[model samples]
Target: MSKSITITNEDILQEIKLSCKTPEIVEQIVSRKVIISAAKEAGIEVETEELQKAADLFRLINKLTSAEETWAWLEKHSLSLDDFEAIVYSSVIFGKLSQHLFTDKIEPYFFENQLDYAGVVMYEVVLNDEDLAIELFYAVKEGEMSFSDVAHKYIQDTELRRKGGYLGIVRRQDLKPEISAAVFAVTPPQLLKPIVTSKGLHLIFVEEIIQPELDNKLRNQILTNLFDEWIKQQIQPVEFVKLFELGS
Candidate 1:
């Protein structure tokens, strides 16, 4: 026979406390309460078809493709259909609230902060020896060797070597200050002189610089960010009591 176990509400709360998840759980509960309260205050209305579409999108996002999969997911998460609907309804409220408050501000925000979103395509090789990094940097710069040639011959990691050490599209904020200064200052298709960091010396190839575009995707991103900040402010003044700890 298969071994079985059942967890009571007391067991769940004990585990949560022991795992030091009390603050996180409490914060989430308070945040949700605050959001629902805000939605009610703002008179946000959710129609049936709109809610259905939100549920479908939620299912798609979570890969609950069919009724069987959705039910399986619900069981795995210890949630019923009613719980699922409530979750989807909250998500719908969040999206609607975000758009309602911040839709007009996205364009202005994008224009003002465009530089922060500017990105670069780069190839990098990390070397333990600063002397060797300098030599290779010069080698690539002088056209004696291509960046690929250095990556293939010098990079020890299999994946890095195969990809020619491509670092993908990186924004300035994602890089070290010194490295960012040097990388962003250089023209594309040029090799930067090696920069020393704690990990190793970096010889970077600047492939291209990508300017930020204020498209539909970026507008939505701005709206979500602005809304999240606003939510934090709204929740700050509210005092939360931990009723979960009071359960006997």
Candidate 2:
């Protein structure tokens, strides 16, 4: 025997007000309307095949493998089948409109910012002591000790130690400026002098520096970034008036 509880629309509005998320919710609503209006002006339309493809992607992303799981999800969200279709409709149309608006800019942007996309594959061992890190760096450089040996002995984290402190392919933007400058300054298969940051002394071994490629994935990413900035600019001057007072 369990007690039945029902949450009403009033409850949701009150909670949104109390949580101080009303402005955020209103912003999202206004943004969606803005995108929809833009889509209409650009004559951007969602085709049946495109909608189906987007729906499949939505399901795959949400792990809606079975009809039952999907129904449960919709029930939890208080959404109908039509609502689900509308969600993907807006999303796909916005993406298509973004490509329509910014596709030409991708190539120029990539070449101009080519250095930002450069990445490296390297291993790292962070230490608390600068002297110890310097000792280990020389040991690896002089072939008196191996990076793997230093990692195994001095690295504290079990998983990192086990992997021999291997950090997979890391982009230049992902590292701190100090680390990035030092890491990319020298050529590969080389030992970098110990660099100090807030974290600790970082003894690094640069395995390889991967050059940038303007592939379809990177192109889409660039398009999305451009669209996001453009849309934010569109949102700045627009103001919304709340129909009701919060906590009223």
Candidate 3:
């Protein structure tokens, strides 16, 4: 004889539907279970002190007043305080895993490449109006007005405008190929004439270039990349069975 199952909590189904897109409670439960299991398998333990530290750091980073406010902020983002702590623990585990698995391999690979990594300071002038873009480009190129001065006057992006279009140190990989090519072509303190990207015209200034150093920081970054690749490989083959399918 087959066993019959009973549903006790109607609210669980409703909560699952509201929290997640599908009406599948089993899928949600399974997914959460998988994450919790994986976290445990990785020996990702969150100490009380670490959790408090994380809560404090989160408050400071987001400029929140208190830990309760931080919890409220997380809830606003559809996350629970427990979920936040789990994420932090998982992150620490992943970091350790990355260091353990790929530090040695990444160090040699980075050194051989000898990438010309440096800091770049730049100002961008993005205008939907082509005529205005061209006009501003010339204004900047000529001694009529400085890039910062024009950026303050005309740039639309509030964040960049406030900083006088100063884009802080960005890696070569972070920039588009065209921008990166132009930036590397010039010497320090050289102004790059306005180049048009999909966004708009960008006038770049190479403020300072710090030559690449084979330091611990670079090694950690390389290890992080390798570990990210490894994690992707690990999670690729996971299969989930929907609750409705189990009934079928």
Candidate 4:
């Protein structure tokens, strides 16, 4: 005879409310629980060192230095250590689940789309004067000076100029449409001609472009995103009783 695990629907609902702040958010949260449970059932466990590593990562990501400080930061956002642990555990489970499912299947897809994953490194010269911009553009094109040198000598944007006008690895999608079009059109180690946009007259240089790879790290990230979407879809049909309505 097999023993039955007896978790009531109400118990599950209350757990969801406490973890997610709303019963309507249950399915996504519960799906993480499902992953966690699956991991445990498979005799998988997150070691203390692993949890500490995750905590360290969490702290660094939020610019904190210690677990206590991380917990304090979470409290400021109305979250608790238990909540943080659950999220970390869910992340571990999700990674394990991805390794089990799509790590092999998606590697080829990742390699095929690798070019789309390139990141840009750029230098920019921003100027308010259109005529000055045109003159500077000519100077740059004629090799009178490098973009960084000109930016340092004459660009008005102090922050960018200080870094020799470096606007570091920005995704094409994140840039303004005209700017993106201009930048992507140029191959790396090449200077783009001056572009006029709403901001100002700009000259850009492509410092480098990093091609993508089909690696374990990227595969895990893709699977995590996919699972999150899947969980959201599963939860969409669920209806819930609000706390205020329950009180009423």
lDDT of 3 by residue, 1-248 (tens): 99998654565555556677453544444544555566677676657776667666756778989767877888787787678877666555555555556767975777676554554665555566667766766776677888788778876778889998787877777888888889877778777767778877766667777667768887777776776566556555666545352222
For candidate 4, the lDDT comes to 0.71
lDDT of 1 by residue, 131-156 (tens): 88888888887889999999999899
Candidate 1, run of 10 with poorest lDDT: 239-248
Error of 1 at 75 (Å): 1.8
Worst window of 10 by summed lDDT in candidate 2: 239-248
Q: Number of the top candidate by lDDT?
A: 2
User: lDDT per model, in order?
Assistant: 0.86, 0.90, 0.68, 0.71
TM-score winner = 2
- Comparing 1 with 2 on lDDT, the higher-scoring candidate is 2
Candidate 4 local lDDT, residue 76 = 89
For model 4, residues 1-248, the per-residue Cα lDDT tens digits are 99998876677656755676664444555666666666677777677887778767767787988767776888887677798887776666666665665556576756665555556898887778888888888888898977777989976667877999888887655678788787777777888777888888777888887666556666766666566665566556645444343212
Candidate number that wins on lDDT, 3 or 4: 4
lDDT of 2 by residue, 1-248 (tens): 99999987788889998999988888888888888899899998889999999999999999999899999999999999999998999989889889888999999999999887899999999999988998889889999999999999989999999999899988888899999998888889888988999999999999999999998888888898899998889898997875787556
Q: Which ten residues in a row have the lowest lDDT in candidate 3?
A: 239-248
Candidate order (TM-score): 2, 1, 3, 4
Best-to-worst ranking by lDDT: 2, 1, 4, 3
The residue pairs that clash in candidate 2, if any, are none
Which regions of candidate 3 deviate over 4 angstroms? 1-92, 112-116, 129-131, 214-218, 243-248
What does each candidate score in C-alpha RMSD? 2.0, 1.9, 7.9, 10.0
